[model samples]
Target: MMRDEAPIHAGKSGLRQILRVATTADHRVLDALGTKFDLASRSGYAAFLSAHASLIPALENLLDKGPVPPRWPQRRRAGALAEDLAALGRTLPEPADVPDLASPAQRIGALYVLEGSRLGGAILLRHVTTAQPDAPVAFLDHRSGERCWATFVEWLDGLDCGSDEQRAAIEGARLTFAAFAAQFRAWLATIA
Candidate 1:
């Protein structure tokens, strides 16, 4: 269950749980925003990649400039996303506005969103592969089997978040979710 869904009341004192509560609505809205893509056809899958390409690259770029989370290098999906798009004979869309993940706390918050998505990616990978088995699916396939999420959550939960840090983290997660949502909505507009 996601931090939002089913409520992971375990480790209530941890930053991961805190972020889960703080960004529950944001996560829900973002997921709903993504349901815009059909994902049943190769073209719809391309649109899905386009939507993500617009935001994931911006987040990954910010992480490159900051105190990155554990296994962050391995967690990056932008390259794989680009490779998949190329295989589909498509190019990445322009990135959305970069979220201001300036501080370590803020970056951690962004990382929370980034790592958290991997859980959902498992389900998405299955659908995409079944729907378009021949499509380039590197982005969806990236690290589908791993302990990265647990490692990231443990790192996130262990940190002692001061009030300032907590606030920054919340802001970071909100910005990340919001930016992705906006980018996805814009892509949907184009498709419509």
Candidate 2:
């Protein structure tokens, strides 16, 4: 059975109101963005920090590689990310917008590798790429990790690709990341 009572409010600021509702929302991306800018809701803000706090060390370990080789297992063929993305593309109205299957696979592979290779106390740092002004680094823990769009951009950056191809891949990654982020933020608004 469902209650017919009106929604409750804990008396937070405008921004806080946004954050509180954002956490349980679909993308809940606002939770992430709010944390990034320190504009999160009191409860939501606390939750966000707690979530990433644990991963900090793991992420840092990856960053410590610093232009060094990654340590995750080698996945020469279709992997989790590759399969997931390919499947998603098929269900979409236009798969052309999606990058080649290999691109995302490489991305997931690189992130895994970077995390695997990270040291005991490693931390992940987010940096902006000079090449692409708006392209933010997706959980970089190493110096050479470079700025990427999403899991794929970082993955391709970790690989030994040509300048042109890398550029294209990064661009794709950025778009994917932004789209997901926006969608996630909208979803978060409806969280109870």
Candidate 3:
């Protein structure tokens, strides 16, 4: 699902595919940093969650301010994020400022990044469960039965996206990725 290949040249203009292609570089960079930590260890897990704390909560809060996007409340993870951090006796870091996501297209684009992250969450959850059975993975262990990703994708594919809409969507996603990368780097420095 996290294809890093060059953008598709086929007649594919679906929002899903466009977002995937646009965010590939961002994904790769984040993945590199993501792999740098050992999730099984408490310290490493705390570091990982702290990096997330800098972005997800603030993004979710901004999303909450407007008309809720599809499954918005269900997808909010700031509370679950809090639970996981508290389980480790750590507090969620004060949220970093998110870019202003004022447009509906922008919100959907941000949602694309947010929902896409769930896929990665499943993989991380596996690593945690197998190696550190007691690790509190409340953030990762979200939406046990709901088809969050599928529904989001279906809603995304339903949008009638023109070139301008596509550009905005891609911009929103890129900004989010940048925010995350910046936060991750800052957290990494503190721990180093």
lDDT of each: 0.83, 0.31, 0.82
| C-alpha positional error of residue 130 in candidate 3 after TM-score superposition, expressed in Å | 1.4
lDDT tens readout by residue for model 1, 1-192: 563334333356788888887999999999998877878787778888898898898789888876666778888999998999999898988777878888988888898988898888788888877887787878877887788788888888878777678878888999899988887788778777
Backbone clashes, each candidate? 0, 13, 0
Instruction: Sort by lDDT, best first.
Output: 1, 3, 2
lDDT tens per residue, model 2, 1-192: 332123322232321222223223422443355335221233332222223322333333333343323333321111322232233232111111222224432333333322332221122222123222332222222323432223333433345444343333333333333443543343334332
TM-scores, all candidates, are 0.90, 0.28, 0.89
Better of 2 and 3 by TM-score: 3
Tell me the deviation in Å of residue 176 in model 2: 3.7
> Candidate 1: lDDT of 70?
76
Total backbone clashes of candidate 2, pairs 3 or more residues apart or in separate chains: 13
